[model samples]
Target: MIWLLLLLSAILGAIAFVAGRRLATRRAVGQSAHSRPGYHGAYAMIWALAPALLVVIVLLVFGGPVKNTMMESGSPAAVSALEPFEREAFLADAERVAAGAEPLQIWEGELAPALRSEGARAHRIESTISGAGVLAVVLLGLLGGLIALSRLRPNLRARNRVEGWIFGLLFACAAVAIITTIGIIASLAWDSFRFFQAVPIAEFLFGTQWSPQIAIRADQVGSSGAFGAVPLFAGTFLIMLIAMAVAAPIGLMSAIYLSEYAGSLTRAVVKPVLEVLAGVPTVVYGFFAALTVGPTLRVAFNDLGALLAGGPLDGIGQYLMLVQNQMALTAGGVMGIMLIPFVSSLSDDILNAVPQSLRDGSYAMGATQSETIARVLMPAALPGVAGALLLAVSRAIGETMIVTMAAGLAANLTLNPLDTVTTVTVQIVTLLTGDQEFDSAKTLSAFGLGLTLFAATLVLNIVAQRIVKAYREQYD
Candidate 1:
């Protein structure tokens, strides 16, 4: 019904545009027209569509409450007699029945008849509302179009009016984005403040343990749960460092090769194939990490450890024997594979943007290709490359799905890549999963972690921007 109303409104607007254009053409046939025929047509079209669209918006906003009121007032005795718990469900069932779906709940005797009658009532009420809405849209569209047409003139400035409407629309879009960001910040800050009240900021930031559960009673097994978040912070940093270690050199080298060394044919073939990594879903990477990479590393390490257990490297062998399928190394390696495209694509573009004259000058100076690239091209493109790497770091920090699936959720503070660890994002997801009370420190902790993550990313972005600004100044 809503779509039908929108289509009818559009048709009305189209007809108005045609009528308005013709009238403008007729009126200005002998005089210099102030506005073009197209402008006049658009003016009438806006007028015709505005009122009809407004009707749809109002109906959407208020229709639910109005329909519920009507249903409640006309509800049969059987519905009125239902307990509150069952009443809402039964009412929903009646609505479903009215729409030609079976009632989800069973009813007996007089109640069954009452349910049928209620369904019919619902159908009739819906019909009335839909019919009235359609009529309102058609009438309003025609009335507004007539008003617009009656006022069309050679000097009316229809284009100015339409352009003003466009400016207002663009301003509204900007304001909505600004408002949404402010709202999110405010919500996170408020919830984080609440969490901090329950858990000391120092302990959360510096202490090493991280158990979020709290018991309802003092005698419960885990009443005073540990909340030190140092382990989570350490784990997050370790994984990010390991990921960057794998990604940075490889990604940058690929970008350099793709831009400076690869031929056109090679670039076209290889760049897309490399970028295909970016398109592979992170969940798929998580599966690859967990099912393939993790097990492969564990088995190889365990077998090697067993072979070396009685040798001179026995201590190291014992440690290797403890290597697990779910470890920081597995998660970090997979995440690095995921970040390759981001680094390579951005760095490639930046490297390409460096002046071709610089390369020409280096060659004229008798510098070899390798030296020219190392001494000139790389230095010129450093800021952008740095920015690209920072953005990749931010990407690493925010990743949850791959971390959750690949890295086992144990907030271990140890830095050994073979050990299981979890990041801030994985812990945030763990804390907030399923039914939870916002008042509990456990649940509120998710907001705290979220705020921390946001701040870290925001800082990284600022740094990236500053680096890019420096490069721009150097070049400009």
Candidate 2:
């Protein structure tokens, strides 16, 4: 259905484009005041597309909730958790009555008519929006085209005005992406606020414990759920540190090799191969970390005397030992591997983007490639490299699957990399993955963690940008 709608919209836009052009051509040859044939075409295209697109937006926003409410309100269980045969008979009778036939079927046919009527009404409403939109576009296009054509005289200028409108439209389109990001952040903040209301902000921010199991029955026994976020935060930081430790050097080295050393042919092959890493699924990485890397590390660590000869390594081992099996080191290692391509690609771009003249000037001073790169290129690219590192750190912090699968679920409020720990992202996923009361502190705790994560990332980004600006000014 969505594809069909998109196809129709594209077709309508093309038609509007052609129609607008034809109308413009028919007017005085060089006459246009506010816009040209192309501008009019685009204006018409927007009009043609807006209505159907709005319909889609409205439908998506309300459709699921409305449908769920409708289905729930009609209590199927109350009627009977009926036997299959009985349900079939009921449906059959309903269909007969709905068709206005004699009551030969088991279910009432009146329900069928009602459903059909509602479906028809929805279709009519959608069709009306589409039809009106298309008509409005055609009319507006014709009027605008005529006015533009009339104003386009030998001495009159239309191109500048047309360009201004074009720029405005392009700017608005670009702003949509930024606006969407802001909207998402706002939503996260709102949810986090709700979470803080349920759990004391202090406990969430500074508490050392981290469990989130609620009783399923009145007599079920378990530890009281802990809302302290320290463990998750510690786990996340541990993993992030490990990941950055791995990714940073590898990526920076790769970037240096690519920008300063690799031949064009080598770059052509190597760059794409490196990029393929980014496309690999996080789930694939998770499985690799959990099933392969985690066990391998355990065995290796045990051999190296990190674990006792006969003891099973359990939960966050850094500062606390609550659950066994999570090793922050493993999760962090895999996460770093996952982040390598992200850092390498970005660093490569910045390295390459460093002005050629800087290198030339160094070479002119009889500096070798290595020395020129070290003294000039590295300094020049430092700002961009710092930005890339910050970006990598942000990504590592928010990463979910590998840490969740390999890092262990137990939050350990410690900084040791060897200890198994959970992160805010991992906790959020664990907390909300299944059925839960929305009002519960456990659920709200996820929001609190999310809010903290947001603030941390925001601060990091600001700091990175400021550092980059300062670096750039130094070079200038």
Candidate 3:
């Protein structure tokens, strides 16, 4: 029914548009017009559509609540005497029965007959209200169109009015984005504050241990949860460091080759191939890390350990035998592979954006192609490159699936790439998974981790902006 109403409204809007254009044409024939026929038509269409759409929205928003209110008012005395939760559940079940869906068998009261009668009444009321709403929309739309047509004189600045509306809409969209970011930060901070009340901020930040298992019952063992997040932070940084180590040099080198040295055909082919890595799902990378890279590294390292044990490093070799499938190296190396496209694409664009005149001047100064690229173009694009690296680091920090699958869930503080570790994001996911009470410190700690991650990323962005600004000013 709503869709049918929308179809009719669209037809009316089209008719109003044509009528408005004809009216504008008549006015132009008689006198000089302020706006074109098309502008007048657009103005009429806006008048015809906006009010009717708003009425439909309002009716849809209020319709269910109003119908529910009617049901409650007409409900049987026995149904009304039930608890609030029970009554709500009974009404929901009654609604399902009325709609011929599976009936909930929870309600066993003597109010079945009353409920059936109320459901019938509710259905009639809903249909009547919907029909009235649709009629109001159509009538109001026609009225708006007629009024707009009446106002369509040679002097009416319909174009300016329409443009003003469009500008307002654009501003509203921008405001929504800003407001949403602010809302997210505010929510995280509020919950983080609640978490801090349960766990001291100092301990969470500086303590070495990180065990977030909380016991619900007093008799439960191993419930002594620790909220120290230092290990998670350490693991996050270790993996990020390793990822950047792999990504930065390789990505920058690839960018340099593609932007400066590679032939046109080579650049065209290779750039897209590099970017395809970015399009591949992170879960696929996680699978590769866990199933392929992790095992490969373990075997390689184990062999190296055995060789060393036969040599002078027997003590270190014994420890190296403990190296397992899932470790920081496995996760970081794969994540770096995942991040190559981000660095390469952004760096390639930045390097290419450098003026050709700079390269020409370098050549004039008798610099070789390699020397000019290394000393001139690269230095010029350093700020942008730095920003790209920072973004990649941020990406690495927030990654959960790859780390969870390949880096193992142990929140070890060690910097060893061979050691199993976990990140803040992984821990956040772990804490929030499964059925849990939000009021507990364990669940609330996810918000704290979120807030910390937000702050770290915010800091990275601020620093990157400053660096970019400084370098940009130098080049300008």
lDDT of 1 by residue, 1-476 (tens): 78988998999999999999999999988888888999999999999999999999988998878888898888888788889778778778889999999998798877788888888898998999999999999999999999999999998898899899788989999999999999999999999999999999998888788878767888764487678888998889988998999889999999999999999999999999999999998999999999999999999999999999999999989989989899999999999999999999999999999989999999999999999999999999999899999989999998888889888999898998888999999988888889888898889989999999999999998888888787763553
Instruction: Please rank every candidate by TM-score, starting with the best.
Output: 1, 3, 2
lDDT of each: 0.91, 0.71, 0.89
TM-score of each: 0.94, 0.74, 0.91
Candidate number with the higher lDDT (1 or 2): 1
User: In model 1, which range of ten residues has the least summed lDDT?
Assistant: 467-476
Cα deviation of 214, candidate 1, in Å: 3.5
In the range 196-310, model 2's lDDT, one tens digit per residue, is 7767788777888776677666555324566777777777788899999999999999999998899999999999999898999999999999888877776665554534333
Model 3 poorest 10 in a row by lDDT: 214-223
TM-score top scorer: 1
Comparing 2 and 3 on TM-score, the stronger one: 3
Of 1 and 2, the candidate ahead on TM-score is 1
Q: lDDT of model 3 at residue 109?
A: 53
lDDT of 3 by residue, 286-305 (tens): 99999999999989888878
Candidate 3 has an lDDT of 0.89
Who wins the lDDT comparison? 1
